[model samples]
Target: MVDQRLPLASVSDFATWEPVLRLMLTDGTHRSAGRSARVAGRVSRYGWSLGHQGSLSSTRIAVEDIQRSLARGGVQEVAFSAEIQPDGRTTLGLVWPSPVVEPAVGYPDLGVLVLAEGSLPEPWLRRPDPVPGAMPAPSADLELLERTLRERLPDAIGATEEEISAAEARLGVPLSDELKVLYRVTRVGRGDDFEAADRAGEAVGCELFGLEHLSAVDAAQRHPGWKLGAKRAVRTGPGAAVQGLAGSPGWTCFGSNGGDEFAVDLTPGPAGHVGQIILVDHEQSLGAELVADSLTDFVLGRLREDGGDRRGDQLPAEARVGTGHLETIQAAAHPALEVLSVGPGDGTPYSLAPVAGLPRLRTLTASPGTLADALEVAGLPGLEFLELGAREWRVLLDAGAVPRTLKAAAITVRDERHLPVVPLANEILTLWNRPRIVQTLLYGDLGPGV
Candidate 1:
């Protein structure tokens, strides 16, 4: 067991600064050393002798690295054991109780941060090689798949062996040969153009999450009190309890259309085959079901099939008016239309009124300019999902017009520059208040934000 108590602190210092230190360590927003130094400086102000007042350089450096590692977004919790040297220097040994972020190279479980009295000694760093693991050889099928995908998407490039190894370490799971090959070839981050038809003739798009997404997802899964949202249940037998994977433990999601995913199962259930490809659908009554025997078959099948008609393209001509006309939405009385997307016909913002015509519309996706109009005019009696821009989200909040029937919402930000000037805390609090919406996704950064 690691000793959590900070060493060489007075009782007063312990009482006053321990909680602050813990908060600084666990808070995910402090990514840089400067931020960590600020927190350490605050602690020093609270009666702890971080070092001499005018010469706290060594203490600051050690504290900064410790806090930076702890604040790393994907880290769940950090534990530390501190040794107080006879000469008043301290060596703090650190470990992540459960790391969602991949540890820096050469440090697996242990890191060392040394603080000497009066001035700095050595700079803070991870101790080398605490734990080691074997690396798997890449398979031929994965190589072939990479070559094929690159042929189709000229810009596609595979992840390096080092990248793959890092991902596996972060995930704490071995990647199958198929996945190894795929990642090596194409590290897809934003996949809007990859479209395919599933066996059911549904127009499925593919956005195989890159390593970053995987790390984020892993962190969320490990977060305290996190639950799978709006997942469909699966039953194995007559008396068996229904099982629902908010996201399956053994399944690694490789690609997703809006509503469904193609995942590779590492641990097969009683009815499932190990290493089989499966389709996990949020809209399906059964939730997850088998799709193909292998990754090769799944890839080849999607490639061979013709892209099916998209639901958005099937709307009546009147419903598909050019973006300038908000009046068209109110006028078109299409009772049974299920999905609708509205964008500017011209580059200028398009305004809409509440559309009462499409009472049966289940899904609505619109640009920020048109969202207010859509919300105000749409009766949305059967609405299930909504997609809108970040600016539109603010509009809805201001109007307080989100429909009660909405099950999920995807709020897209085209670029980080478009993010509201509001603090992240306030933004999160507002979203948390919307309990009726079971799931919410904020996507898009234009490569500027994480």
Candidate 2:
């Protein structure tokens, strides 16, 4: 029972004054209620009404009055259109307020929803409304996502129909229904304020900055988890340069839809910038596994740019070892990957090797095997880091390879475990006595501290 008024074209246009026209809203009732009330209040405030003309028969108003009424209400959120039905009713539809009409609403003459002019100053027109009672389509998250995309790439949003259509064809995805409403509400193409943010979408936590709003449902329907990581924004100009905290090459636009994406480079940060590349594929993907050579190439490139450190003559003689199987470490391996951490049943497995033609290549961590494997590897010349526990210590003591030139180490085991002692030459004593080595203390869950 929402009230509305219309104008009569002429005295002869009396045939058009009847209510045979069915009302269709650009934004469905739930979305447009505030707008409807605001429009009604403004129209009432302005003392405006559209009725038939010719005295009682001559004093008729025009449909434009509806537009003026909405305009006066300060109700400019989305643009809408109206379709005149032969039954004397009008159907309305929603659209994105682009310079052209087709991108706003797909069809013409459905119905028109009036908009506030200054709200969306872009050179755009109102969108035609859908048929009455039609279910409004959903794009709640995408609308926000596009807003964010626009913030990063201003040229992409509010583009002309031909431009948007071309981009859509290129992207291979269609815009969502909610996104259309968002475009309309902001008053984009028709006026000077084409880049305005759609307040309606923003009110419901649909933001242009974070990925929290994008749901599994939306991702499933659009890109899905498997294909999502491959999507990246590539920029070739200063205007396209993304801003982020710290100068890290982490693109402000780079974000996870749920899982993870890896970036590798020569720099010290988690995201390496020098000779950088991205792995959009997840850990489970074959493409991810195949990218090892790419990482090595990056390392080589870094060595070439930075020089000396990675050269065969400069690296330390000790072996390289990894403690985690994370993608970062897996991507770090060289062909000579050796010295697996073979202690039984504890901690993550890691592998390491000398980047061929590099200096050091004495030890590495590969798997968590039995206690005996720990001593076997630790006894080797130029011993580096031995990631071990109480069990491995006992095995090493039993194997008589207590300590050698071992320099740095990370040990994680309960303190109660027996320590191998050497009294005379302090055979095992040298292992505990050498204080120069950088010892990293790692704790194990021994229930409660003794």
Candidate 3:
């Protein structure tokens, strides 16, 4: 049934790819590359990028055709490969999206999804821990905030008691006194696009959402991919003002600044107020920035702001080695570590013994040839997500050392030859009895280049 949803036009048709191949061969490398050229690129609803191809003007039509085909097939992301033999014979390979491929439209690509369809990353499954030390900020004044709003916008209508109760019921969390008082002053009915924008800008620093628009900023609101989520851990520093979490149920969204949300933080950080405000940016996958100490501060032009750099070197829970964040695996090793990412470096492969048996470590990513011993991965018992080069994955597959604890995995493509990536991914998926990556290949001859 999944196959039925694919491009109705034959993906195996040589004609479908002939235009692109002809244009690719026009890149002035016909005598060298086109004579036996190998071309590859990823295309999807987002965009398309193909190297070793002709000018954009010449390739635009062909690229558009492929994208339209993907749209018809309802594919979010797809990669294609074309291998042209010296004899002019061409092999076109199309790697289609599957259930486990991760349908991420707007969410961040934190990591590649290697598990069954329903399995979410650890961060997406976390809830806000109780913050016993959190209390109301000193600036939180329900009386002042309401009085100021009423004076600033005397003509503005306010929400009824029933509307406030409805929002509380919908969010499953009671609004803080500051939040209740602020909303009571104005329910913010949508007045036309321009007027609504003006009203929100004048009332709040951002576009304020009405009572009906108030929603809970919870984990389900965000769907981060495996690469980033599995490679980073959510953590707040010792004196953080807002807890470092992917999302929280207690975060009641009230406004938006384009790609960010303004919320009341009920579960605040160690040095924060329970009724403080936080800004959750879309570009980030984890944690909120302390935008205002309290709603009163946020409204009365006394807003206090600070950056969320307390997590220190991208948070203690996540450690990246060899990619310039940290120098060695020894430096990255910590008892609280959860995500270990090893990137390509100039030096020789690093040993994994430093991170061996790390209690909380669950996710790992190692670039090609970056590990001195691929089999050392067996020592990480808590690994739930993994990504390694094809050769490294093969070593694990052949030695029967692949981590049994892995819920999902990926084979990092080292070069343009994606021909091996899917097969390796399928091999790993089969270990867990999951569906394999669907591949289609077409053969043709573009003929000797002009």
Candidate 4:
């Protein structure tokens, strides 16, 4: 770890990561003597693999050349950009358009930082290598990666059958096996954030690296080492269970794409509660399923507890909440529950019909059964937010029931089967016919904002 205590030389001291690493190049007392020389050396060692996979000319020579150029001290600014998922919007996003780069590259976990004097190094800018190479490194398939991510994140990794179809439709081309894997891993489970690093998983923060940066690193196993920082993981059980990734996992994306997903864990933290843990796994992996499943079983406390949402008592336990368990849940007096908020568990689609009689309920956010079953929810006068996702929305519209007491609704509709059950315009006209209908929403455009 970079000594958090050592006072840096100047404001530039912090910026030029290339030069900062000179302090550790050798083991002797004056090991920190040739700070400038070490900065150039680190730059030469790290800058080659900085751009996209096929974009860079010489991964090795590029590193050496950049280091030499930086030695002369003529470099100016470096830029960085990362992806993000906008709120309420399904599309993924990029937050930082760019960042300034310098000589020293900091590797927090390995306890090293690079420092250079002048111009920013370009890992991609170089002459071609005259050597031959072998097969490429192994990258996980996208679909499998998504499934694995879902296994880890049940609730946070949501995708109705309709949304999946919509995604396929919008892309115009089938999602590459690799891209799919990355998408699933990044957005599979809990709501969280991930940090972007060069090749090593060491970074300043969760600023996602660009595709070019990732590709170049994958192409060349060796290059200037940039640290992909640690993930800001929330505590799983009572306290925090922050797990750092090994390296910058492969991220394969296409033109203009971005999205978000949350990360979750059942581990206990400092407090006695298994609080909601959150992190963004941008480099989500397809192989995460085994880990996720094991966690779910470990955390699903045993059966036969004193009812009443016993999540408070749910210490390190393992369980499988099957459909059969739902009826047993009805028998309980509101058993405390800590449902893993990630992908579908045990390859089963979850469809539960909530039993009536629990008057203590204040909120019910679920996609229940057919329209008839949801109409029963009219009894829940206190219902806050009704999420009638694509599948359930179809059920309600098919049931021909318009909930009377529903306060607000967030509906999911796929372009394929999203034809209006009742013409939106006609519904508005009918509401206009009502004498007490003082407000209305037509075509999703409000008559007036209240």
Candidate 5:
């Protein structure tokens, strides 16, 4: 006999309370568990409790809370006994002696377990049909993928409903519920399975774009004659954007890696199913290959490809490659690359320097001569840290060539006495005087005019 005494104000309060039993199981190597619908019907004659609200009665549990708790994975199977408060709010308490269960296993003892005194038999309780497409109701595979991503990538965030709607409206197509739920749970960027550094230390794989990127792509596609490499122009005519979105065999891009993109095929192919994902390489003019059947499957399948534990965080922080190797440097560029060393070697210097091609380059280490050659080129938008010879730094400052994006610099001054004093505007001075600038190391000794 379980403790059934309630600190209720009246017998009516006790009568309003109800017991919602849900069977959960720990699966895979991690042993994570959430609500399982498989045993919902078998546990009791009353079908399954679907929503956060435990039942039609006042007793309930908020579905959002359950998702938050299960997001990181720890709590296993536990029974939630819901009681109605005097103010009409539902308060759920954990039941003792949680049913140790496996998937598809039936526990007969749960049918006879008493939640509260005078509780009626399971057959007497009301059972409602499960609501479909509820929030935080992701499948087991998606749930595990979400957990893995959250653990690996600290910057990942769930998208708001407004963000999702805006992205769909801009794309002129209805995003699948799976994709929406994925974005709602995790706005893609640099995730463990998504970004891996190649031989040149460049990030490879699908770089998942956010709503902002989608907006930019939308605007770019609308311009006349705008095209991606040799591929057909993105539909820009009135109503043409979404005309073939449903059944037409076309690629709809959602994310990109500067030149290539991760796209979804709207219509099915001979071997490919509808809504299948593929990698479209625009730069190489290469055709796409089937990646996954669905958006969720694509992400989960990628994570599973590396034995479920491949993390981009484990990659090296910096990469050093020979100078003038544009293809080599581009191949190695990844979101994780913070420092890049480009220098002169056996290869001929490119007429157009390759440093600007790296999307996430922060610190650039190059010979003063090498840096001078690339002064005309642009595209190091994320560069913040710089390392160069003092003479080269002075040359850039004299020519006003220093990018405003540079925050910290390390000048290797062989002779401080030879350092030139260049006139700088207040705006440039302010940037040079910033706190990060103070930390800049001026290597070698300084000589005073004596």
Candidate 6:
């Protein structure tokens, strides 16, 4: 049961977390549960979960107790991490969303956003570059496209010329010839005639939306959150047939393959045709898959298929280094590098030297102790969003070298020592003259870890 009589601020105190930690340290399913160097997990209205386990039956009761304590205190969700000092001093740390973090993120689900005055990352601001010389695919045939659709849906009703013109004016873009012809033959709608709409979908190879429902996809719609979206990099390879973008106004979505949308890509990739068909996957907020070189090809089942991971010596605009992926920073360094993240690993720490001067690099995230020299971040001149562990940021702060180009930032926490980094986060906001992250410190001792 929740203790309504108890003071609300005790949720930050160590006494509130001791029972939860005891169960976590003793009952976690992981082999390292009790003896591990540290323990961390998230608790919310959905109950609680750790990196390795959920609320195991044996620990459920105890877990609920702490959760109740927090609920009565008005906390919807909280993250806690704990570790025992080598000298045997046990400490616990807790974190929750601050007022500044609310609007900058959909939810503080993964990385917390320490936004600096509502700034956005580079990718969020990325629009498809103008391609003036682009042309339609050789497979394009407006006459054949219109004739074929009319043949399949002979009794269909098409959109009026006035409707098409109104759509163009409303969307502020002209419909490609192929698109106009398709609409002229049949403007699909979710009408009472389910059988007719289904037949139209079958002819279209996907569920078709009505003329009024068609909309151009663009970058704003792809924004997941500044924390994740800001870290993404859009790089259209030299040979790519589709322009890598968050979304494109030229991508006029007209149908759906379940959750994904089918669009006529008026703004093609560097090696693509102007009016190619592209599949905008619902799961991905960035880019589209080329379906066919033209609407004619799409209906004829002449679809494009790509195989396997596209890799080369040319570094991706975004990359992860340290341990499992790119072992060395040298492997990730590239002039086109836009986002770089460093994580924890064994052996010696990494240096930021290899990736320091990349002109396009805008994001940098180094986990606690991942960087050999934290101050080397000063060499990264173009960073607009930077995330580092508290200690790493401390090094940068002490040196007065926080990157001035940062639009938003974050601080990663690994253990109890780095638990209350709100003061540090506020200092980050101070540099940008932004509102501070409000934090209340709740201190207590849980004694020694067993």
TM accuracy, model 6: 0.82
| Residue-wise C-alpha lDDT for candidate 2, range 1-450, written one tens digit per residue | 111222112211222222211112212331222222101101121232221112322222323344453455453322222333222232332222221111112222111111111221110111111122322112124445445544544443343455445533643434333333233233232333423333322332222211212111111112211111111111112211111111122111112324544332212222122222233333322111111112223222222233111113211221223333222333433433333333323344333221322223333333334332454454345433344554555566677765454433333322221111111112333444431211111111211111
How far off is residue 113 in model 2, in Å?
69
Candidate 3 lDDT over 118-160, as tens digits, reads: 7767888888888776789888887888888877777677778
Model 6, range 1-450, lDDT digits (tens) per residue? 112232446566566666766665554342252353466666775567655443577557656666776777677766556665433356555655455553322222224544555455677677787777889988899888888898899999999999999888877788888889888988887362888889888887888888888899867767776678767777777677788787878889989988989999888877888888988877787778888899899877788877112433435787888778888889889888888888876767998899878899888888888899988988988888887888888889999998888777777755533345656776877776666644333434545444
Candidate 1 wrong stretches, greater than 4 Å: 1-140, 190-205, 215-234, 237-246, 283-287, 302-450
Relative to the unseen true structure, what is the C-alpha lDDT of residue 168 in candidate 1, on a scale of 0 to 100? Answer: 82
A best-first ranking of the candidates according to their lDDT comes to 3, 6, 1, 5, 2, 4
Poorest lDDT segment (10 consecutive residues) of candidate 6: 102-111
Please give the clash total of every predicted structure, in order.
Answer: 10, 67, 9, 83, 7, 0
From the highest TM-score down, the ranking of the candidates is 3, 6, 1, 5, 4, 2
- Candidate 2, which segments miss by more than 4 Å at Cα? 1-335, 343-384, 388-450
Cα lDDT, model 1, residue 36:
17
What would the per-residue lDDT of candidate 4 be over residues 1-450, giving only the tens digit for each residue?
Answer: 112232212212322332222222222321232221111112332342122233243334334433444445443312111111111111111011012111223211111112222211122122222112211113323344455545644434333545444554553334333333433433322223442122111111123322222221121232232221110111123222222221112212221113422222222123211212123323531111111111122123111122111123321121123343322222332423212111223444443333333343323334323233445545444332244444555555566654433322333222211123113312422322321111111111111110
Worst 10 residues of 2 by lDDT: 36-45
Number of the top candidate by lDDT?
3
Question: Ten consecutive residues with minimal summed lDDT in candidate 1?
Answer: 120-129
Ten consecutive residues with minimal summed lDDT in candidate 5?
A: 436-445
Q: TM-score for all predictions?
A: 0.29, 0.22, 0.85, 0.22, 0.26, 0.82
Per-residue lDDT of model 1, residues 1-450, tens digit only:
223453322311323223333343344342343221112211211122221233355445434443443344333333232322223232233333321112112211111111111111111111111112222212225556556655665655557889888888877777778777666656555343444213111211355667545531121232111011111112233221112233445567767766667677665444334555666665533334666655655665633122221123233422444454444555544654545567665654444444454555655667656543544524566655555666665566666666655544444323311112122213423443521111111111111111
